[model samples]
Target: MHETNVGQPESNDDSDGIDQAWLQRRTAAAPLILGVVAIVTSVLMLGMLFGALGMRAGIDLWRAGNRRWSVILGVALSFVGVVVSVMCAVLWGSVLASVLLSRDVLRETERWRGQRVAAVECSMLSADGVRVSSLHPAPPMDRLVIVFVSSGIDACGQALQDLAAVAPDHPTCSVLLVDRDNSAATTRAFALLHGADFPVLASETLLPEPLGSVAALPTLVVLNRDGVVECAVVGAHPRSELHTILSGAQPVVATEPKETQGP
Candidate 1:
């Protein structure tokens, strides 16, 4: 008589041989499927979902000492897939935000081009010793540039530092840092840290409209001597561009919400 039962078949999971349960459930192929699926989903920019599942599967396979070339490939590809997914997600999100903002809120903001914004009180700035101007110190300024900033956004903070860097190439315009979302003490410290010679304004109570209601960060509101807005630029601009914009006649065209590319 010929015997059918002989030896245990090889298993990628177990170093010695396949287990009894492994015979019932095809657990060996599960990791490979998950890892491959994760990669596919990541490519679709749904990496947050399948990428995680694939990564977990990969980790399990690695920990179990799966030495098969297919499983190893799955493990490696899963990691790569996760990274691609994250990068794609961020890129897509930024593009969407920029497009939507340009269509909606930014379009509405454009309407305020010729409207005169009120001069904010000097009490908005955290000055301990120096006498504060009752209103914006606009009497001596030919142009007033109101820069709305947020403490949360790194670009806004960098905008303050950039303004400081360009302080040497001073403009006839006076730059005012209006805190859209910032604490008085932190705003004061932030300005001082960046060596901002210009006026930095914040209020414990919400300031008036346009200034208080502004949604975009690092937005520059350029005004003439009459407090009427000549132009408004929304984006993170470098010191050189900022100097030119501040020093020039008027900025009618606004830059797209993205990192400025230098000529």
Candidate 2:
């Protein structure tokens, strides 16, 4: 009877060991899933915060109506929220993804940080035809891509269509198109035709000679984010070429001097 009791204790010990091993495996996997959830939640929260701020600013702008100063202040504050929102999203996602996936978050963070964008102002016929200049003081050493098209060139209609297709895939890049003529009706029509998500400026003023020399119609130029002209293509280009340009590598087209373009 005493021998039988001793064997029972050994059997119980083995059962406990098995249970512990099972729990250990579960413990290891839980963090990866939990970490992902935490990271996603953090990003979503930030997005909500920025989205709310933008809405508030928009409302305030509407209330102020033609009050230029009030509208300007509201717009400025809204931009602040946008910057913060983006930082939070990237940081949160990178940290969590790194921890869960056991990868370097720094590389991911840098990938996002490398992106630089310029909002080109297009005024076709107006005295204030040059709005792209306002985005200066941009990140140092950024490439400048220019779209110089006139109404005669289907600048708005086709340009917007091309942009909408490309923008989502290349979130790290900036795109600006200057309409050779500032035709409000044409601009509106272009917007209606191609659900353009980026800025499309209309100007009546002809693009300067140097810019005209680089790009003619349905043209795309890939510039280094430093505001230097990297490569200029006279006409439409393929997706692969654009991707190459975004990576700071020259596309397999014309290598141009920076002197022809502005940052």
Candidate 3:
């Protein structure tokens, strides 16, 4: 047989020039390869990272000699990737914040139950700037609903919205907004903003026993004529659910706050 160079390709030089050939091939393909990677990653939400890689490779390739379509394509991919990455970042950030809020609301709700003890008549400063010292009304209303809230909390905000709708419909029931952060002025503003016409009360200390442990906002404690807790729940409730809880004509499961409107 004629001289046979077993596995080596005829076009590839011997070891002396192999490195140079390998480097040339690698340099030529890098921009196109990275550009494809960046484009693919853009669809998978990893555009920003791969985009940077493609940009460097494209710049290096352009500096070598000519501006090929591959070089332009590489640069274009970087621009598109950067834009896509920024938009996705904003959208995902908003979604993450909302989920975190809901998670906090659910955490507080899942652990607590309704209290049947005396409604702790802690001292409070009313929204009108008058000092009051009771969880109950002067005449002792037929029913009482005390809502605990903190400033800038979404669950509390949502609960207040529900209260605005149901509080007025049931005049016999007394409703009060208890401020957890001692933000009397802010709470008053919140009450007005959410349309909760009920009394907004704030205290500098933790509310008394059975309630002193309350560390979460948007906690609703319902009491009977005797000023004893009949139902206590955490988290935001819907208008209809609030109405039912206040009415008591129907059985109200108030140990844990529920998503009354969602499927």
Candidate 4:
């Protein structure tokens, strides 16, 4: 009878050992499995959904004190998932904004094309209210190119350069750079850097009500010989398009030397 009782204790010890082994296996695999799931979901662009699951698994493994490397990898994958999700969101937002802006610009262009626009009899003023006629020509040109710009914007400077290059091509088209907000010094600096041949004017208000309000910087407006608005582009346009528009108008053969030139 004593021998039988000792044998029973041995069998119970074996059962306990088996149970412990099973528990350890489960604990070791948990974080690894969860980490793989998180990584896959992140690659699929699921954002934070599976990331939370992986993070929870990693935390659980850390508490269990098993599979340290698995926990580390799982946490790292979860972090990557979160970052990818954020980047995807920003990319989507930019795409949506671009689509909407394009639609609005197309509609505006169609509405203003071929319509007669009133001449803006506005005078250009210096920062100190000094009248600058060179920046604002005294009418009589075949076509007028008015570009509204804000200082320190690279896109605006590029637009100015493009217009300046093409302005000389079409003698009839006079290019004017209108400053939205900037000191005379800043404007001069930009003009110098870009080698602008057109006049730079400082104005608080947008000229010619027909062109509507200046909602965006670097708005380009083309006026015909009769003071009619030919086109108004809200953003920077390709040089080819600008040239096409200028080419449609009659070129003035003579060059009038009244205003600003490249320094």
Q: What is the C-alpha lDDT of each candidate?
A: 0.66, 0.48, 0.69, 0.66
Give the lDDT of residue 41 in candidate 4. 67
Ranked candidates (lDDT, high to low): 3, 4, 1, 2
For each of the candidates, the C-alpha root-mean-square deviation to the true structure, in angstroms, is 10.3, 23.7, 8.1, 9.6
Task: List TM-score per model, in order.
Answer: 0.58, 0.38, 0.60, 0.71
Q: Write the per-residue lDDT of candidate 4 for residues 94-127, one digit (tens) a residue.
A: 8889889878866766455555555445555333
Query: In terms of lDDT, which candidate is strongest?
Result: 3
How well does candidate 1 score on lDDT at residue 116? 60
The predicted structure with the larger TM-score, 1 or 4, is 4
For candidate 1, write residues 107-187 as lDDT tens digits: 767666766666655645545533355333366666677787766677877888887787667556677677756666666
Please count the clashing residue pairs in each candidate, in the order shown. 0, 27, 0, 0
lDDT of 3: 0.69
In TM-score terms, candidate 2 sits at 0.38
Name the regions of candidate 2 deviating beyond 4 angstroms: 1-137, 140-142, 152-159, 182-185, 202-209, 212-215, 251-263
How many clashes (backbone atoms < 3 Å, residues ≥3 apart in a chain or on different chains) does model 3 have? Answer: 0
Best by TM-score: 4
